[model samples]
Target: MMKKLFLFFKALLTSLLLSACCELNTDNIVYIVSTNDMHANVLNHNKQIDLALISGLKKHYDALLFDAGDAVQGAPLAALSDGDDVISLMNAAGYDAMTLGNHEFDYGQNKLFEHAASANFLTLCSNVYKDKKPLLNNLNLPNEGRYAVFNKNGFKIGVFALTTVQTLQSTDYRLLNTLNFENEVKSAKKMLDLLRPLKLDAIILLAHLGCDDAPCTSKNLALALTGVYQDELDLIIDGHSHQEYVKHVNGITISQTGSRLKQVGLNVLNFKASEKPQVKSILLTYEDLLSKGIKPDAQTEELEQKFRHKQNKILQQEIISLPFTLYGGEQYGIDLSRVTETPAGDLAADAIMYALKTKISSNFLKFPAVAIQNGGNIRVNLGPGAVTYASTLYFEPFLNTLTSKLVSPKILYDIFEHSYRYLNNLSAAGTLQNIKDSGGFLQISGLKIILDPNSKPKVKAIFLDGETTALSRYDTKRKIILAGNDFILSGSDGYSILKDIPTLTEFSDEQDALISYLKHLKENDGFTQYLKAQGRISYTQLPKSVSAYVKIRNFHQQNKKLKFHCSVDGEKFLPCFADKNGLLKFELAPGDHILQIAEATQEIYLNTILGIGIKQGSNLSTIPAVELMPTKE
Candidate 1:
């Protein structure tokens, strides 16, 4: 009996040992870490996230790091070194591959070349060509825009990159002059043909085109990749729109890390290839969790801190502070043109536009009409106190340049229409009728005009160039100069109004122009009139909760000159419209509620418009403190 028991136990032990050994020899997993739209957040919180990832990755699998594109430009760091320091930091961080984002050309092609050459890792862009030859030709590196294949544990990983087609619009780098952004499908197909011969394991794409919930620059590329170009593409890491989402479309895994390197995208891919390499499964992981007691890798953090200190020093050299806090935002006030009144928006716009006019003055382009993209575009807003170099860099961090193209008047109107549509969708009040003395809406620059949200479908009048002209009466034949940042001119956010405009000339820089213009204008230290909104047209503010009963108490005409009526809602209230200053007060029941502001002139109403709801009988005496939430997530 004892001998039989021993034999049974010995056999069980052997079986267990065999199973354990087989597990140990199983195929190793390959981890690909990618980031995009870093936009100068090199020394940002994202750096900490990157450190945490390296520590975790080293313990589990073989890892390869990639920055899809837009590495420099858009932060104080990029502007400080003209991109060299960023390259150095990237090398220290152990980046294996990187591509150029459109903003990379902000300083022009020469600087871009310097950055590309300075980078320690493999710099690539299959589409960028120069002097009729591939940009990467003689550089001891592989040709531009070609995939670099890596062999790991018997699996071949082919990696490639693609930038947004719109990036070509800028002349900053002239990087695309000799190259063409061919159909992604065709390009990927050709690359696949070559990759297949290697009998590789997986194909990865580091795409810097923008992605969104709807089909956008990067999302379209993803579809083309999986559905048409190369359905076999194992994974696509995207950037551009500064959005985030991890999804599986048509068996192809797509993942994107939010902009500014707030987090890193990690995908652990399992594979098996007896014949053709096939992905068993792909798991999407992130470094955000590291904040919860997960310490970053000591070495990486130390290196990043060093770079950050250097970046801070460079950024602080030229920034200036303001004397007063900017108004508008979540509080009450007209949106468009309103930002111009604030020291923050007006000062920045004034500086930037003035720089352009001085630098690029010629017969063809006489006067420049500058547009300061709303508060949303102004990434950083300096407080009333001290403004440091870091603050300015954080605000105008994008390496956007003063680029211009000759656009037709018709196309120009289309651009306005596009902008108008976006504002409409956002429930933004454009004209004076739509403007509120306070609360959330689009913050605009330049023209002081009124938006009639209730007006029938067309633009009525436009006040600009020191003239208030009736837009509806005049023919659209007139042409005027319009200046703004690359995003607006690039026609991003559906503003295709300026897309078809031909290129007149490209300015080396508008920053200097803006600065010079401001200094010259402010020589006397006179009160330089900033842009302000004259609310002629306004969107109707509606109640948020429809389930609850809302009673309109009194209705009085506010802004006597504008003569616009605003409805007051309260159990017993005074229906007083705003005076020229746009102030109105009313009583309300004790509870949470929203004050709906609308245009009383036309029945066509704008909902959730503006105005602060009073909490019972509390705090109307204090002017109700207003605040804007932080832009960073």
Candidate 2:
């Protein structure tokens, strides 16, 4: 009788344990591992391997790994394999998911699709769409999904990803023409709503928007999605803008690891299946991980060594002696050459024109008038001595077509205006400033530009190549001026003024043009490169005077008389009136300024022709009408 009673109790306990579901689970745990903006530094970076061991993840909790984007656009290793090695390493490291960052599209859309398809883990994003249909799902990438759910001990955790909307501006605009990204705030709401009816215990949003991108960053995302208080989100993983922070905001936990495998984030999820989950996060910095005595991942280390050995064999082959140090990547580091000018900038612009002259019949528009290169086009710096193929290619990485078009002085003025427009600001784009605000800082080989921040026509004067026919009578001459480079000819990088210009012809790739020029220099013994200003480009303070043209549009139909006052440089408003054409025109002191116009209860910021500063003008100048919106509570 005693033995039968013991057996009956054991059977009942087994039954109770077997029937328990995720809906009534008593314990659940998992770990989230993420990397962002590695930029393919495979040989130099191997921290991800040790991070796994340092976190002690596999021992006590389930692990899920993810990458927030920008995995494969820089460094020679990534360039040679087009990210195949990156994919293999990520697979071996056991990444569970990833989302596309802007640089993923650097190799073009089709190749990017291939990279996404080839990955072992899911490539996720909730807002990318093509032809109004979802892109991540329609691409049919085997592991890709809009959102994912993982179950641990019968407890389900839902997750989704979002790329920055600025992606279109940040990536090659031409390649992503067919795709569109939605506003992040609205997209997040939609994703959460779709996952609401599921049996999820918590939701996690892994975002690439960070603290620097602004209005679209993680902090802003939290403000928009959760308002002043946290509601549905349990944790947020973020990347992009390359910052590091581990903090709890608005009752929600947020974490980010810096780029290039500099750090790894470990978020420990502590939960009961039926209640709101709690999160604890710790950042494993590179130094800290090293101090833990966690050995470098052997597999990744081997992979990196193989890549370096292969890459060095080709990259180190001597091409030519630099003679002098060539510098670039001044402001953004590994991107733009600089806002003003540099030796590397001169070399690139001169190389293009030199190649065209020697090649002949390269009439971009009846033979080119000038050769221009975007500063953002130059990458990395090279010191004096033997330069290798690998090093050369690293400096001039992206595959941009060499194209040209004829532009008028008026439009050319707009280009210069765009260049100097960033004179006052340095954060978002100290060098380039379109929506993405990059690569438009100009370095020219055929002309000189004099920019006066105080004038309406900021370009005070233009001088022909060799400094002949100095900007005198330049405005009077609208001679069809030829300029090169697809980034400019196609009107990217705040060059909207040239978008409509017809392409006369497209030639060899930019890299090839540079190589030809380098070889020609080698043959002629002209390797002692020299680029003095010769007054080609000058940066000066306030001009003698400045002018403004302002127009008011009544969208809400509140006023007709347009009664208003004007202010200069944030000063007190003085009484002002519109001209016969319903336009307000005025002049003020020239250096840097702020123009505001107020009528009745409404006020608007007036951006003049040629913007902020320009030489006074009235003919054919289109006044930029800035619309003012009401502030929200």
Candidate 3:
């Protein structure tokens, strides 16, 4: 009888213990959903996951939502509304907090403050300051602070934000001259010192610093704080490089979701009463959610559609017609604008020159006014037909004003050299990471050059606007005025050589300039001239009598037959075929020879222009295989 009583008590005790443990587990877990570098892609279109889906996830998981910045100023919606539409959507999506990205300041300081005032959540920025005070405080945003503490699931969570110091060079310096960005690591330590006193359960550093090459990056920040204040920082949500990663440095977690709503990040924290909390990071794509039977929130989707409908009325207005498409980088399966010259780039540069010529009738025009548009500024291709204001806005959306300066020929040489520096170090077998294109690559109007990538100085020769003769690198007789956007003229994108040069004239923004130029082309029937690349830039000086091998890979399995053409030493085009192993072998003469490969198949798109240099006896057998895209038909 006594043994039976004892067994009954033991069973009851076991049930009680399990119940307590389950309650503790339920109260201790916290969920955080994050996104970075969204770049104003609030809708679910063009392979981009929607902000409404993010809202659905947040509600379903009972999670906190935060953006790592660059949330504004890329699409026509943001450009037309100066980012108000994005903020409105973010507010509707239930953002808990966000940090400032470099592009956040694209519209200027007053607009930034206006955004902060309109935000339903906190705008946390610990690094940026002006006149020895936080920028928010200085700008009279007393309600928004550098750091905020939240009580979630019975635990106090501390969150602080940091913006990259590179913002000075990435943004208009004039707009940010008064502001100072603190060193990321130093600011992190300061934030830790302040947050630790409050005895928080977890601390997060929300940063716009990327994980790329760095004096300032989230990875560096993690490494820097690993030993000294390792226990102080629990997690870091990073942005600005448009890379996706979730890694641990020491005991702290660093996570980022790539740009344009490609993926949404989740950090799950499990806390206990006395021990260190455990953290786990995860990234989810739209497909992942769909497979799990998750649907976008109805309210958020309705709100997004309302905004879309309002914007489409203004954005759908037609601007001009085109005979053929102008190609930008990536859309045509090649990095045309950044690595080589494209017709779209040429048009952007010409627009600047045309705007300047029409705006100012000074001697600057007489002295060879050449315009150079940074390839990065030309965001998209124009059109094949019926281009709209929305399309043009997407093509150049930063809203940078036009500026011109008279610079020396030496400075001009430096500009061209700087543009080609990224290409000069490329290897025959370099991967995409190694062959990364520079944003500063110049797309020119009224200039031509022969670029020898393998030589000491990449700019082999430069020609004045209409002059057939090449200008000597040391020539000083002819004066030249350089016209471009304020971003490049003010020394952004490493064009410091052009900085501090007195401005000869200032014109309208880039989009306006492009519109005016397109209208002029329409009136003059010059659209046909822009249908193909103008050969404003050419590659030359390849090794003579050297053999090279080119390999091609077909991306589309539907296309079986393909034809190829080869131009050797800039000679007449000749038919070529790859061997059974799919290798095109080339033997060239010793002089400055140019070898080019063109596709003759209508079913496939040529993705790369393989320009290689080889030694006398060496064959470039290790060159990376080029990709070929097949048409849907």
Candidate 4:
């Protein structure tokens, strides 16, 4: 009996040990969702992202949502409330965590904190602090640089957040007075020390340092992360570079969904807690929860609608009567670039620039120049219709103030070098292409140059107050004052080509400028005028030589096998016109000639190559004789 009792107790002990070990091995599956660089479009896409998230919450009840900052500025709605309404919406969306993006400082920290009260999410950033406390108060949670721990099916997890150092460099709201972003990795280590004691299952770093594709942003930050004391950090949810990724680097998996609530980085990390912890498999996936078929949450939709009506009331008031529809007028197909003929772009730029000049005339600046961004940036097209204040506000919603800086001649040259990209593909052929590759540098109102499309960018001549002058005669010996918005002057378009420029010289508040300009118009006999291009630009072609074996294909598909036709001063040479199948061959000796390709029946000129060179060497060929569309004359 004693022997049997000993055996029974041993068996029972073994079974219990096995059962306890299996219980400890259970998983804690956590879904991490993150967003970054979301410039608040609260009334439009912001609401869209929120509704999409609410939809996500229904699907993944246990997922944690984090917004990586740059969330409150850029659009008019958020700017109007100074981010208070967006905070209310964010709280409604149940955001779990967030960090301040650079733009957050646009209004300064005091407003940010007041708005923070409106956020239901956990405000975090290991970098910035005031009086030894995180810049944001109510961080009752320990700041030991440790993670926020959550229990899931008997598993322990931790999450932390980081911001970029550039946040301090912005003049948005003057943060240099207090906080500073120390090296990200240094703070990460201090937090790791605190986390080490917890014996956590996995660590997640919510990063806001935007990454680039080449000299990667996240990868660069991750290199810093290698110095971190903890080995348990298995995942990094990154933002900043406004990029998308689903990959692992240096043993840690980093993921970021593209910005503006387009998608959320959804990651599933499997962990094993043993004598030593290890990550099994990290699967990254993006949930395009923002689809048409998916209905938005009823509660979120109701809140968005409430704000939409109020915003519409303010945006719907008529502001002006435009002579022609512009910014892609729906049925009218009007172009803003036709600003000379259509009063839309010209009128808007005039109003804004005039208001700014009037506001800042105390300085002896003369003949101010104003330039708007490219055509693609013009989102809405107006028609011969009553322009509403909302439409104007919506079209130019950034609310950017007018600013100027004294740029050195050398620096201005560098800036112009890059800005030539804008002039290279102008829609109007008659528009001056004479701007040397280096010439289109100046975005101004007091000058104009005629450009030939067929030739390189060499200024034919420039007109200043209707008097033509050779451009080469003018040099950068004198400083030319320029005016533009903060975004433009900042060289946002890789045109950091301007030098000797002050950071930001705010002259007139954007909204104030608009209002003042509008009132000025109401006072000045309703301001009637439009700008039109007053110059001729064309490409003259000359063929140097044409040898035997010159080949041509159908200019158009209809006459596929037709013989090719070449014209030298209106005289036909070659195997003449091809048949319906436009295919032609030519043989000729070296000579000066004009080559023109004409369609068989339409009688439209397909292409004219002036000054084309066929070397005296051997034979030459033109297999595909098609050409780009003609520029607007």
Q: For residues 1-633, what per-residue lDDT tens digits would candidate 2 score against the true structure?
A: 999999788556434422332112235655666677676654553334332342233222346777788787655566667667777767655677788877777667778778777887778888888778777665675324688887756668888888888665444356677898988888888888888888588788888787663348777777776642257888888876556777777666888877666677767666744478778666665554445444555565566677678877867777788644555544222233445555577778888777555543433236327778887778775546787777777778764556556666666666777876654421111111222234677878788887654456567777666655554434535664454676667677778877766554444346656766777878998655432222246645434444655555442343334445776544688987765555666775422233566543333222221242221355424453444344344
lDDT per residue for candidate 1 within 364-383, as digits (tens), equals 45543544443454554344
For model 2, the superposed segments whose C-alpha errors exceed 4 Å read 1-27, 45-62, 139-144, 226-230, 272-274, 317-342, 348-386, 393-633
Selected candidate, larger TM-score, 2 vs 4: 4
Of 1 and 4, the candidate ranking higher by TM-score: 1
Cα misplacement distance, residue 313 of candidate 2 (Å): 2.5
Cα error, residue 49 of model 2, in Å, equals 8.1
User: On a 0 to 1 TM-score scale, where does candidate 2 land against the true structure?
Assistant: 0.53
Q: What is the C-alpha lDDT of each candidate?
A: 0.50, 0.62, 0.74, 0.50
The local distance difference test score of model 3 is 0.74
In model 3, the worst 10-residue window by lDDT is 600-609
Query: Model 4, poorest ten-residue lDDT window?
Result: 602-611
Q: How many residue pairs clash in each candidate?
A: 57, 10, 4, 40
Q: Give the TM-score of each candidate.
A: 0.59, 0.53, 0.59, 0.57
lDDT of 2 at 223: 70
How high is the lDDT of residue 303 in model 3? 88
lDDT of 1: 0.50
Per-residue lDDT of candidate 3, residues 488-553 (tens digit):
887889998877665555554576678879989989998866655677887674332445555566
